[model samples]
Target chain A: MKLLEDRIRQDGTIKPGNVLKVDQFLNHQCDVALFDQMGAEWATIFACKPIDKILTIEASGIGIACCVARHFGDVPVVFAKKSQSINLDGDQYVSKIYSYTKQREFPVIVSKRFLTAGEHVLLIDDFLANGKAMNGLIEICKEAGVVIEGIGIAIEKGFQEGGRELRAAGYDVQSLAIVKSMDPDQGTIEFA
Target chain B: MKLLEDRIRQDGTIKPGNVLKVDQFLNHQCDVALFDQMGAEWATIFACKPIDKILTIEASGIGIACCVARHFGDVPVVFAKKSQSINLDGDQYVSKIYSYTKQREFPVIVSKRFLTAGEHVLLIDDFLANGKAMNGLIEICKEAGVVIEGIGIAIEKGFQEGGRELRAAGYDVQSLAIVKSMDPDQGTIEFA
Candidate 1:
């Protein structure tokens, strides 16, 4: 996690309202090598768990989950699409969540065939802010009767309650980099 | 290529409206091992080009492009955002594209900072039908003044004009699986 913390310190920019932009390497533009390394770290952390699949959301989470899947024995990565697609079938587990980034509520959908009963699934994503998106996935997981193995997040805002709430719910959430605090004016960030 | 073709034949379903759903292993639920093999295949095909970055659209393309980046020496994978997010800056290369699956027009946006002038880029996507999305990326690449070495596609509908038109436009488009024809009624598919 030192490498990720350092990368965030070097490349991350803090904007007004506590927005940390790491798009140069993390989100919009991705560094696959870094993703692979993050995968290795998460694999080490979740070595004891049985991970049958990696569940993630669309867009940002797909790259990280796909790259990380290699470390988890090339597990099938099931991404929850943001909206309904014509390609999707009627048998789907859907959960609605509000995305502060997009500023709208969209349904996270996954085919029921992908998640079987008693399957161990590890949820993965780029960032865990307020836990709305992760909560959506967890809701679908509950509905599908899949076992929640763990949640692997690249960056977690410790100041936010997402990570704390999941831990309180008795979930093993492993975040690579936890931001304790950040300053937009002076451009500074502290890790937990 | 044969591996992908075989996968499609086995798991792909032919729906009405010329839709071939391979969500079991390709887009929704991703098989990272298969994606790595595709990366290897594309690496071999685009070996001669100097690829500085792998450019793709959001969602489906991000997973394949990230997995494929490993085969291309860990090149940076820049995914075009489908909409304008508050996280994105003002300086951007924007192109509008119409999606048949979503039945709407969306903006394809790439941050100006990620793309540089005179850089070699390889465009990647999950599917190429009418080439609207690909063309949008190409337009951004042109505006950014980047050199497009090639366009790598996982599947191309040979019955559609996307691949043929791209080839006629003097782009090296490599599609692993090209569908010559498919019958939804008969549940049969023929590869080109």
Candidate 2:
């Protein structure tokens, strides 16, 4: 976690609208080495839980989730698809998620065949903002009657209610780097 | 490569219209361990080239790209974004690609900062059908003035023209598993 925070401090840019531009290393242009480290950290924290599958949203979260799956003894990773595709057919557990970054609501879905009843699922993502995506994933898991083991995130905006709301709901949520505050004018970031 | 071919033969479903449903282990639900094997194989194959970075498209390619990056000494992996978002700003290299599976064309964009001139990039993807995505990625790299060392694909539809076109164009293309043919009724698959 310290390594992640340090890397964020060194390379992350603070922008208006409380956005942290970490595309240099975290999302667009990824640092797989850092992802492996974060994966190890998540595996250590969630070692006690029974994680049958790692769930995530498409695009950004897939990289970190894949690395985390490696640390979890090569557990299978299931990513929820944000857009409906021809390849995705059959019964699916669908939920609507509001993307604060994209500033819109879209449907995220996982095939029913991928998730089943009584399975212990660990949800992973790149960032936690308003907790809308997490809630959507949780909703799908609940619909499938699967047990929510925990949620692991690469970065979390501490000023946002997503992390706080999950913690208040008694979910074991862990974030590698939590941004406490950001000052765009000063180009400064405070981590929690 | 044998491991991947075997896994595909075992779990891969043969649907009509030449659709190989490998979502169980390749795309939707991913096997990181197998991906590491594929990565090791790719690294061994592309070891002769000077690869400074691993480039890929978002969603499915990110997982294998991350694993492949690890095998390449933790090289940075940059995934081109399929959709535009707030986080993506500044100069970008964009290309339009037609999806054979999704049955539509979309734009793939990469930040100019991540890819620069004189860098050797290796493109990685889960599947190579018509090669539209690969072509799109190659176009982006060309626009950035980056040298494409080669292209790596997990599964190449040999019946399709994509692989043939790339090889004809003098690009070093390596596919771990190339499906020569598939019979839906008999549930049979042939690999090239």
Candidate 3:
């Protein structure tokens, strides 16, 4: 987590309204090496759980999920589709996710076949803000009758309630870096 | 490549309207082991080229790009955003792509900072159908003044004109599996 926090401080940009721009490495442009480290760290934490598949919501989450899946003995990764595609069957477990970054509510979908009943699932994502997306994925997992083993995230907005609420609910959630606060005036990021 | 072809023959489904669904392994439900094989194969093919970054389109392409980047000494993977996001800055190289899967046109955006001039870029994608997405990515690389060293595809629709056009234009394009045709009525897939 120290490496991720340092990377954020070095390359992350803070704008008005607590906007953290990490496109240089985290989102738009990805650092696969860093993701590998983050994945290794998550694997170490979730080593006790039975993770049959790693679930994440696209498009940013795919990179981290793939890297993490590698460390888990090449476990299958199932990404919840955000956009409507012809390839996806209509009979899917759908959940609504409100994107704080985009400020819109959209449906994230996963086929019923991909997630089997009673399978242990590990959820991963790039960022956790309001936890809407995480909740949506959890709902989908529940509908599929899968057991939620744990949740892994690269960055968590500690100031937000998503991480706190999940922890309060007794879900094992691990975040590599938690941003406590960001100040545009001071051009600084505070970590929890 | 043989492993991927075998996976398609075993798990791929043929739907109506020339659609071949391999969601069981590729795209939606990703097999990290198979993806590692593909990454190794691509690394063998594009070994001579100096690839500084792996460029791919969002959603499905992100996973393969991430996997492939690891073989290339953990090169940066830059994915083109299909839709506009608050995380993306105003300074971007944009291109319009016609989607054969959805039968629509959409914009692909890449931050200008990620791609630098004269850098060697390897374009990676899950499938090459009509080649609209590949074309858009190529255009973005051109606009950014980056040299596209080669292209790596998981599957290529050989019946379509996309691969033919790109090859005629002298791009070193490599496809793991090339589907010659698909018969929905017979539930058969022919590969070239």
Candidate 4:
């Protein structure tokens, strides 16, 4: 995770309210090369676990999930859509999530056919803050009767309790870079 | 393309209202191996063009775009987000798009910083039907004054006017698999 930490320190922007923007290469504008490294790291970390599928939320998580899926021997990546679409009919495992970034609550849904019973699932995402999205995905996995193998994240806000809570709960959670602290006025970031 | 066509014929579900669900591999539950082939195909097709970046819409398009970017020598992949967030605060190029699948309209926004003038961009998407999403992406590129090399689509509804219109308008649009027609009752699909 040294590369990711360095990239964050170099390219990440600090703003008020604990915002660390790495849009240049992490989220909005993606760097596939960096993602490849992150994916390789995730694969190496979870090499022992049995991962049948990679689950993620829509928007930001898709790219990282796709990259990680390749590393996991091209496991199928199923992303939960933020809104229900006509195509996604039939039984679904839905969970409501509050987005601190957008400041809204939305239902994240996955077709029941995708995540079936007894499958080993690894949840992946771009950022982890309050862990609302991660919890929602975990809820969906539980409802589908899938075995939660682990969680992979590109960046984790160390100031937040999401990572700590998941670790305390005995989940195998791995984050590439963790921002321990940030100062908006000085534009400084400390890594954990 | 033959592989993709075969995948559709074998795994794709035909529903009423012209819905051909290939979510098992193409979108929701993505096949990174197939996407790698797609990325190679697009790279071969547009090898002559000077593409500085790969542009796409969020959610479904990000995975395909990331794969395509890898084939294009790991060019930056910039995705237009469907909603506004706290991180996206500066000058943005916004376009409204009507979603036939979701049956609603949403605004797609790209920060002006990621896409700049004089850069060559290629738009990639999972599906092209009414061309609203593609057009919205094109509008965002134009607003940023980026030169569009072309548009790459994994599946295009040939029965729909989107592909025809774009081709007629002299845009270099390439669709890997084009569904000429579909019958829900008979469970038949014809490719163009």
TM-score of each: 0.99, 0.98, 0.98, 0.99
Best by TM-score: 1
Candidate 3 residue spans exceeding 4 A from truth: none
Among the candidates, what TM-score does chain A have in each? 0.99, 0.98, 0.97, 0.98
Candidate 4 segments whose C-alpha is farther than 4 A from its true place? none
Candidate 4, after superposition: displacement of residue A99 in Å?
A: 0.5
Clashing pairs in 1: none
- Candidate 1, CAPRI quality class derived from DockQ: high
Q: For model 2, which pairs clash? A: none
Tell me which of candidates 1 and 2 scores higher on lDDT.
1
Query: Model 2's DockQ?
Result: 0.86
User: How well is each residue in B49-153 modelled by candidate 2, as lDDT tens digits?
Assistant: 989999999889999999889988899999999888999999999999988777788899999999989999999999999899999999999899999999999
Report the error of model 2 at residue B68, Å.
Answer: 1.0
RMSD of each: 0.6, 1.0, 1.0, 0.8
Give fnat for candidates 1, 2 and onward, in order: 0.96, 0.89, 0.89, 0.93
| Weakest 10 consecutive residues of candidate 4 chain B by summed lDDT | B135-144
Candidate 4 residue-wise lDDT at A50: 97
User: B1-192, model 4: which lDDT tens digit per residue?
Assistant: 899999999999999999999999988899998999999999999999999999999889999999779899999999999999999988889999999998999999998999989999999999999899999998888788999999999999999999999899888999999999999999999998
